[model samples]
Target: MLRRRGRLPAAPWLVAVTLSALLLAAARPAVGAAAWCIARSGASEKALQSALDYACGPAGGADCAPIQASGLCYLPNTLAAHASYAFNSIFQRSRAAPGACDFAGTATVTLTDPSQLWIMHLPFISKHCRAIRNTRLSILHSELHV
Candidate 1:
């Protein structure tokens, strides 16, 4: 007769997998929630300024705390900068709903995360790229040999 192996308890493993999934979901940005600012090339300067004013004012319904003096996002202190913050705040708070990012043609919604652009522009991005390339090469080499 063949010997049978005993089974281990599954509760702990199930809990661990559930926790990992929740953490991963929390770490990622909300789907379709990415925000775009009006301060881009070819946008009308006057319209952008007006949109910023409204976004920061009570009419726009955005929390302007971060853009205030001495606030975390207060630096740069330009109209476009402040407006971008306000517009993004509103867009996120609204759960990225349809028309949430449309600031009277001053702004548009984008699927790409805006923070990724900042990260790419950082001085250390090249180092990160090299590391990723090296990792990919290692994986490819191993796969080919296998």
Candidate 2:
């Protein structure tokens, strides 16, 4: 009887595949961020003040949304939207807004649809929304309101 040649086992391939898979999984980009639904709404002028008042339960509130650029990360989407709207209630007014401020101060954004909205900086976003509003308003003021 002719002796059969001994074939090498394929264990290495299995290990390689498993390791590759793990590495691939680890390398996945911030994909979940796409799942977020973004929407915003502007609050009344000084909405922060109003919210504080409401939260305070009839104390006249704190007089502001209680947030800054760095603080945007702490605010929820809904809260941020309101604050943004309030800060920059006027679209045309925002168009002429200055740069590098806490919130944009003229636009309102809506963050909705997905409850688990993955925001990088909640406060920053809110601020930007306001800024956008301010910019738009400024433009309007220059173009029409003026």
The numbered model that scores best in lDDT is 1
lDDT of 1 by residue, 73-142 (tens): 5655666566666777777777776777777777765555454666322111224434654787799999
Which whole-number lDDT from 0 to 100 does residue 16 have in model 2? 80
TM-score of 2: 0.22
Error of 2 at 46 (Å): 22
Per-residue lDDT for 131 in model 2?
A: 69
Lowest summed lDDT window (length 10), candidate 1: 119-128
Off by over 4 Å in 1: 1-40, 119-146
Every model's TM-score: 0.52, 0.22
lDDT string for model 2 (29-143, tens) is 3433221211134434464445433432433232233343433232544454434333332222334233311232323233232233445344333455456557877888899
